[model samples]
Target: MSSETRNTANAPRPTASEPAPGSRPTATRRQVLAGSGAAAAIAFTGAFSELFAGTAAARGHGGYGPLVPDPDGLLDLPKGFRYRVLSREGDPLRSGEGEVPSNHDGMAAFAGRHGRVHLVRNHENRVTAKIGVPTVEGLTYDPAAKGGCTSLELDGRNKVLGERVAIAGTAVNCAGGPTPWRTWLTCEETEDRAGTNGYAKDHGFVFEVDGADPRRTGAVPLTAMGRFQHEAVAVDPGSGIVYETEDAFDRPFGLFYRFLPARPLGGTGSLRAGGALEAMRVPDLPDLSSVQETGARFDRVEWVPVPDPLAAGTPIRLQDFGPKGITHAQKLEGCYWGGSSVYFVSSFARSDEGSAADHYGQVWRYEPQKRRLTLVVIFGPDTDIQLPGESPDNICLAADGGLMVCEDGGGAQHVLGVTRRGEVYAMARGRQNIGTPEEPEWGEFAGVTFSPDGSTMYVNCYTPGTTFAVTGPWC
Candidate 1:
């Protein structure tokens, strides 16, 4: 990694319990969640701010108590909460196109016509996968690639109305974000090019999926967004700027990117017109995990343009970036837009992997207005894998004003909740036995999204491909 810190003087260090040089004291969790400095404060920005505001408005208390074990050995939840399996791998679809593809990954929910909800889900399968997304007419991107997205429709009662292939033939369709115009930006988490592994066309691009009308989703890749191992994206509602995360784990690591559209707020097909793709830089900080302090603030944040977003030859991360090389992180995953900032996650980092520092996980808030970045949440390297504060992957602002986080770590898998007070609770657990009876294995949860009305929570189990609708007294 580059040792350049041309802008290190701009960053001011502060502990969570202390205030910056001359700024006001940071709000306590109680004060922040109590509607005081809920949105403006850096501690409660992005999904944290949204969670604080929503929970404060609803007068919510410490998360929904503790999680109760499930007798079915499927999903364990709170006492009042319950989960229903909406779909599973090999499940027959109402459209009769094919069965639900495996590797259920990232997803988003949008309001459908006449009191209905449409969910666009990704299948993180590769070329060799057996149960690949069905190649539907007008929806197939690369017929040789096997991963894509499926759209599911549900009535007001949460009953399945229909299911169809929203986009097909893309590779490693991982996590993505929902657009304000009611569409899902599905990301391909691969960098395979044409003639690679029987691929018919180049992979690794963002494709817009219209949950309401699949026909409107022409399976076109947004090349302007750049080609890399894209993990997830969060679109700024007001600016229409798309913030993306790269999950590459090689030497140089992956970078955090943002795409400024040529035609902002132009809805669905606007991204295809082309735009500027840039990688983030934090002056002197070369790797993200190096910042250990929770309240660490980088005031002079910068974005370096990607010489070639298409990566025709060298990958973006390996590309030259003058003297100050682009900043990178180990496992950059899961991104979401909330309040006036964009929140992104660094799943974990290790010194063995050439990282500046080791950490269990981190949630960073970036404010485009001020061009500032703050480290709001940081899980220490000593975190217990059995606990709820480890390796948070896909994240979403809960309806009740807490952040819904999915566990993608080593130990037991869980759908955890992070309250404004920094309290972590297990909201749901997986009981699948991928191992022997003596050593039962579990799958990590992903795509933790909420319905438009906030009445239901939808998530996916990566293994065995299960989509669940969880509901109960949210507050």
Candidate 2:
């Protein structure tokens, strides 16, 4: 998409008294602090103020607990916690035919009866040789093909109650958002291709699956969500608006996008039938190519709306606004909707020399009311703020009001927690080496979600894939 397209969607307007659809009701100052638990946590860590001197200053209110790495070939967390292997990359297919695939990324949990929860998770494999094709118990997959989805049931104790494959022949299943209606939107991040064997038209669309039924088919791709290298999705519950991030690290990419359902509150059961896909562009920075090539920082940002988001699927170029006003730091990925603002993180940036920015990652917040964007955090290649380059993937909000960032950078991969006050703490470090892209140890921590009550945390690894449950004293 073009810069003009992006800006049109994010144009700033005068602040209005009326809040956005899902904006929380205004609370008294005392209520806000009491609700956040920030003050109490800070006070509990009284010595934290002294530790906040230099790089330690960045370690906000929360501190790291002991790491309980499990080498027994099973996932484990803190002492009070326990985890079950909900699913694995190459487990025998419940469909009674093939095997489950690998590269699991994002996932969502839904409440089930009797204290059970249903999980709908994504497999990011693009039908490769190493990992064979995915097929459900009753379904079938060509031996040569791969890529699919899975559904599983876990009880309160984090034990896998049941498991099954939902869809197959998909590709690059990345981070997807959950709809207010409770279905999981599994996104395929690649365009379909026609080969000698047949046409694979299931790629590059959002497919909604029944979170409860793993064997149930009827998985339909929502063409309205746009076809791109999708990374993550965040939804505004009241408005039913879906905000999505694209993982286009290579070249010619667009900005973050928002989809307004054509039926307003529609798409509960079907996403393809309705919705207008719009890409964001900053009107102030109309000429992105020139700005990026010249290495100029266009501090002013705006959101422009895209006229034709689905035009990408057609042969003709739709609304081509050449790279102007766009920045090299445009690879928008990992977004979570929270705190009256949308928090997003960029994986990395390409420097003026065409080399990747060293430890260049930014956490940005989008204020819907002001239509404003702010740079909340920037990481450098130092010890305190050290970040794996090119792999800052998924993020989740902590009960303590901080961010749980899943680092995807090779060897430096880790699950880092960044508090709202700007303290960074390593929650869990991947077993992978920092500089090499060897098969990620501890897998790439992508999918992260807290239980409804915010007591337990669930994390997933993308390669050598496994899901872990981490519980602690939130009370």
Error of 2 at 136 (Å): 4.6
- Tens-place lDDT per residue, model 2, 1-475, is 0001000001222233332232221212110011111111100111111111212124245445544565543442333444445566667655455566677788877888898887777888754436744554343232233665677777777667676676666677788877767777777666554452343453566767776764343555566777666767887656667788776545554457777766545445545556667565554443122221111222334444554555545511135445643333445678877745666777656555343443345555665656655444444333222333234677777655555777766444566665445445556544433234544344578888777666667778777676666666543
Residue 41 accuracy (lDDT) in model 2: 16
Provide the TM-score for each candidate, comma-separated.
Answer: 0.89, 0.75
Error of 2 at 83 (Å): 3.8
Top candidate (lDDT): 1
Alpha-carbon lDDT of model 1: 0.80
- Which window of 10 residues has the lowest lDDT sum in candidate 2? 1-10
Local error of candidate 2 at 182, Å?
A: 1.4
The alpha-carbon RMSD values of the candidates against the true structure, listed in the order shown, are: 9.7, 10.7
lDDT digits (tens) for residues 315-371 of candidate 1: 999999879888999999989877778889998898988999888778888878777
Give Cα-based local distance difference scores for all models: 0.80, 0.56
